[model samples]
Target chain A: MNSRKSVEWRKKAGIRAEQGDAAKGDKLQSLGRLEPLEQLESLEPREPLERLEQLESRESLQSVGTLALNVNEQPILVVDGLTLESSSGQKLVEGMSFTLRRGESIGLVGESGSGKSLTLRAVLGLLPRGVQLAAGAVQHTVSSAMVFQDPRGALDPLCPVVKQVAEVVRYRQKKGRREARAEALKLLGLLGLPESLAREDRYPNQLSGGQCQRIVIAIALACRPDILLCDEPTTALDVTMQRQIIDLIATLQQELGFAMIFVTHNLAIAAEMCSRLIVMKQGRVVEEGLALDVLTQPNDPYTQMLIEAVLPLPERAETDAGAEVEKEANERSGAEGQRIAHAEESMPNTVKKSRMEDLKEDSESQAEGGSKS
Target chain B: MSAELQMEQVKVRYGGFTALNHVTLHVPARTTLGLVGESGSGKSTLARAVAGLLVPDEGRMSLGGRPLEKRRSREQRKQIQMIFQNPDASLNPRHSVRRILSEALRFHNMTRGRVQTEQRCLELLERVRLSADSLDKYPHEFSGGQRQRIAIARALSVEPELLIADEPTSALDVSVQRSVLELFREIREELNLTVLFISHDLGVIHAVSDTVAVMRQGELLELAPKEAFFAQPQTNYGRELLAAVPKMPTASGLVR
Candidate 1:
């Protein structure tokens, strides 16, 4: 409900603000709760929310009801007030709304049961058994594809990895088998799969988790869909592999220009990859804003808890060697300075208390002889 | 100083592939050793070797200065315990929490009577910060984090000298992960348990471990104090892994 109001206000203000209606824009912006106009100015139509802002800009204020109809020129996908219910009438997701323009990346972030994945599944028309689209509408003008969390499960266990990718290309692009195979190899190469692995007739089980995920991405890319829905794509991956996948998706989004809605439970990952974020809880959107703003200065208590809960990196000492390593690390990765600062500020008080409590328990246990049997 | 657990030039192979290659590591009696690497990097294999589930193809492992037998004796088995990544898989679905924990206690001969066993079970659950009421519930009834806590309780039921936790918090939410990582610290201190925590997450490794071991492609890359490892990793691969971790987003304008 709050998100809907902000979306309307942002839609109106983004138009007037960009159109140089300073007085009216500032007034509307002030009414909007998420971010200031200056910050919102950086907001691009890359995410679903920004498309809504773009939608409200094109229509008269009274004609906001026609939002779904005016999707010809902009917003490839519009999900408005989409609700999901079970056969028993239990609401699984309520009033979830967002829009996706071409080449935008939005992150849906929350805890495990927050319905982030379900929302994406709903958009793909793949709701689980008994869960039905009970209310609202999902209007899309273009084809879409999905990348799942468990790549191993999403892929066919019996199919050769390249053939699986090639099948999607052959079916969707309507290319001949040989041409599709060639195109599939090229796509796999672009995704950083080696020639040896990509060319081999290897089953999904034969490849590692990272390679399987790459093949899955290749399949999603083969469809050449306008929108990509990723549901916790990197949740099953290791940190290094996760980083690779994030970098790959970002690069592909830039190169291919596909609108993306990424679902993840990690706020840090969301902050890195998505320009805008929508925080969900109990099948409802609790907060939505620029990813940086939501992560750094969250308005919702649930979001704040998520930020504080992130395990801070270990504090590095100021030794000369340490500084050298830090310098090398920073040069290799540009985000180190911000990372250190955030880690310093967001160290949880609960962690500190637990550390102290642990020490106290340690001494007490030693006094009574340790619990080692 | 004698280490609680020691591995020397350990090697393991599956079919023709080497899963662990000439790896050596040590965990002090009362400290945590955080083992980190990408998937397929032999972290899990090393944990399995330590837990006596996989006998190393070469080299020797010793606990408390005694050589570990290829087939561990019942007493030797009681000295170490493992907690797996997925709590649901590690725990039996059919058993109640009470039964799951009491079975461990009885199998290990930790308690003589039902009353004493029940008391020990309650204490174990309390140590992991779960309510005593959870004892009657099944694994599926609890949340992922709670299930993990129960898994920890079952591992502690044996009062083993060494605990091998393989990505125990990876399945949990960030908030839940913090509490579980904290619980690991508290338990390690309270019970003086030596921990070998395996994870792909560097942040979790940093939070819970005193020493850090970096593994890559079944080989040890770098092993150092937690502070040193984070500050200046010895190997390029280790540094790359550290740099690859997604940084927490700070407020805009805090830094360029």
Candidate 2:
């Protein structure tokens, strides 16, 4: 029975590939121009890891690190010297390099316009309009999936949530409609979505932000992807929802053992979720190291600034009394107001002081105001 | 202390859905009150009611001891201003910063003549920490944080007694968010502006607010002084919300 199912799956896969080619043909005809997408589409679908394993075996005898190398372990994706350029030939991302090993997670950390998201998009062959992969090669060793910051943007507004998930399962898993529906429901259940929400007819608009994100994750998992690329998946969520989604992603990563590349501007999140962190600024990596070392003792000034910008939790109360004393000292000199003015001057371009520190300064200046009055 | 803005059991409903159910809140004169909740908890609804965009189904609201009308008069509208989560949505893309601020200045008859209006606009920009050179630029020319500053400047142009900032910093990056929050603090201190700050982020609420109110499912759960709320929340929902906040990972027993 298993052999018969395998035969049926292969036949379905072949038919699906042919249909994909036909669809690509229609796209090419409509565009009236042959693009590089044709080259990507023409490549035959093969198990990515199998090719890597064959390459490893071929080079085993000549390899110098054979004694120390773990034969069973291999990187799921290797991005080498990746370069992205705009239509005007301005380099957006230059010489980007990274690797994702099976079951490992890496975080790409940067400010806005830092090309972190662009690099992630480059790996999925989904560069934005006018942005092209000017150089570099991405050796994707397995199927991958992406979870976007806003789940609503990624989902179809008119389609039912369950139908969307089941559609991915049907196409990627080569399952029948009924089987795909069952699998989709199971995946939604695993993601902790409610029965009412996981219903077959509920549109994306009907669900809450958190529920929509869960559906998006369910769809991504339905493909059984070997690599999960999350581009600020939790950024749009509330604090509680963000924590839930983060934990859910971590748990799913553990259960499925998929390599993950999470992109975020948050240092605390990068520290908590990723084992390795890559700090990016202006389309180039400034620092890359273990998450613990990079967060605790960052080498780059930009990385340090990013770390300092994180709002420290308000769990400690001992600092309040110390701040009170400092306020008194500053008030006595009548320079408290001047200090604040000085702080404001340097606020825009550089990393300003944290909120708590500013609060202390506010109280000091208020003390000066009271004394003057 | 006199309350600058007061809500007495305000109830807002949307076709059988209670967006806000008999919620009462008050912002003391010249102080900041942070209202925090999950999405759909009616925080935005309360903000709308205060801004005269939404009329409550039940209960009364007052501004400076005067009963607020369902549709505020032009004079009453000038006493309160609102800043939204997305500055891009609130700002007009086609208008320059000078045009936006001058329009607000002229609407309230706050200034006469182009010279006086330009001076007042420059003052507004200075208050929000933007330079005068920014006057000629459009909304798209500024970054997210800068556009928000422009929005604040426009809001302050009318010199409102109460400012309603609903998740003003949520769309901004963390580094930029701190500077904006500091600007809010500075404005409150300088102008003595009574602010009703709404956000889903507790850390931001803790940092900027003198008082904090927690709401859930259209119901107000807890309201207390900032320190008191953080020290020991009175409700299970409040406790759960606080616990759910993702904490900054500290280094080897160091809290900072």
TM for every model, in the order presented, reads 0.80, 0.79
When just chain B is superposed on the true chain B, each candidate scores a TM-score of: 0.96, 0.96
What would the per-residue lDDT of candidate 2 be over residues A268-321, giving only the tens digit for each residue?
Answer: 777667778999999999999877678777899999888877765557344555
Q: Which stretches of candidate 1 lie over 4 Å from their true place?
A: A1-73, A197-199, A315-373, B1-3, B252-256
Model 1 DockQ class: acceptable
Task: List where candidate 2 sits over 4 angstroms from the true fold.
Answer: A1-72, A197-200, A316-373, B1-3, B253-256
Task: Please give, for residues B9-68, the per-residue lDDT of candidate 1 as tens digits.
Answer: 999999999999999888778889999998889999999988888888999999998899
Instruction: Write down the TM-score for model 2.
Output: 0.79
| lDDT tens per residue, model 2, B1-256 | 1238889999999999999999888888988999998888889999999999988899999989989989788878998999999999999999999999999889899998999999999999998989899999999999999999999998989988989999999999877898999999998888888999999988889888999999888899899999988866766667667767655555552221
lDDT for every model? 0.78, 0.79
lDDT tens string, model 1, A271-311? 77776799999899999987777877789999998887767
